[model samples]
Target: MLGGISIWQLLIVLGIIILVFGTKKLRNVGTDLGGAVKGFKKAVHEDEKDTDKPDADQPQSKVSHDEAGNTYDVQAEEKAKQKAENNDERK
Candidate 1:
């Protein structure tokens, strides 16, 4: 019994999901999800490279954010704060 659910119960839920969405649809969904994850990882790797070779003219936003405005790195927050201060000073 895992998490108060039996093996049979888990199988039943899986069967229902399979029935509802069919095998082909599920395969497509899995493929799409894998592609999205691969793209995200590639972008992050590129972003890391860009951060290493800093550009003077373009302000680098080392920010990796989510839909709800949640930042991935603590350093991003500090950089944003510093940027805000710099902008405020210039005005």
Candidate 2:
């Protein structure tokens, strides 16, 4: 018994669903669901493969410059923002 519903009760509910929606429609819905699950698994597997390998093109530290020609550390900027937030909260 699942949630106190007997096998016979489950069969009746399934029969009603089939009657409300034809077999063909149900089959199509099932096919679409299976395809979505398959694609999700494939994407997760690819992500795992990507994380396992390190690329040479990616630098150990990343830097970006602006039009004003000011140089700043990427991590330092993040820390600065956090400090500003803390100051604002204190005020």
Candidate 3:
């Protein structure tokens, strides 16, 4: 018995796989399989969040820049703009 699989069955399955895809190629198959599984889980989680959220017509938060050109939002757009300006000055 080949690892609890009948010897004949194991040999036939192995032969078919080796013929279709060489041993060297099959070696990295596990990594590819794991990546696909990880991506699937990420997509499922994102879908769940989207479903939980209301429609676009629902009033959502938005950022508006004041007369002074100062931005207000969850993130500091003013700080980001200042950083970009500084970088431009360096160049």
Candidate 4:
């Protein structure tokens, strides 16, 4: 009845899985599944908490400058352009 799956269907699926991955492997699978479910629950709770608070540290603008005299945003753009040009040359 769990997730609309009948008992017989569940048994058949379990049997197939057991045949494919033996008992020891199935135990590992169960542990992995439990870990994944726990992680999912934690993630959902974290998302709810995040939604309740404002993320002040996150920047709204695309460009960020450092204390150095050198302009980093322009330098990054130039580097990306050079990389694209190099890729074009290779092709």
**Which numbered prediction scores highest in lDDT against the true structure?**
2
What is the C-alpha lDDT profile of model 1 across 25-85, one tens digit per residue? 9999999999999999999999888778747458667885457855489898899999999
Regions of candidate 2 where Cα sits further than 4 Å from its true position: 56-91
Worst window of 10 by summed lDDT in candidate 3: 65-74
C-alpha root-mean-square deviation, each candidate: 19.0, 13.1, 7.6, 10.4
Candidate 1: clashing pairs of residues: none
Q: What tens-digit string does per-residue lDDT give for candidate 4 at 1-91?
A: 7999899999999899899999999899899999999999999999888787776557677775566776459888999999999999999
Best candidate, TM-score: 2
Candidate 1: count of backbone clashes, pairs at least 3 residues apart or interchain: 0
lDDT of 3 by residue, 6-90 (tens): 9889889999999999987887897799899999999999988888877845877798656685555846778898899999999
**Model 3 ranges with Cα > 4 A deviation:** 1-7, 55-62, 67-91
Task: Sort by TM-score, best first.
Answer: 2, 1, 3, 4
**Model 4 residue 13 distance off true place after TM-score fit, in angstroms:** 4.7
Give the CA lDDT, 0 to 100, for residue 55 in model 2. Answer: 78
Compose the digit string of candidate 2's lDDT tens values, residues 1-91: 6899999999999999999998999999999999999999999999889887877457678675556766669999899999999999999
Task: Assess candidate 1 and give its TM-score to the true structure.
Answer: 0.55
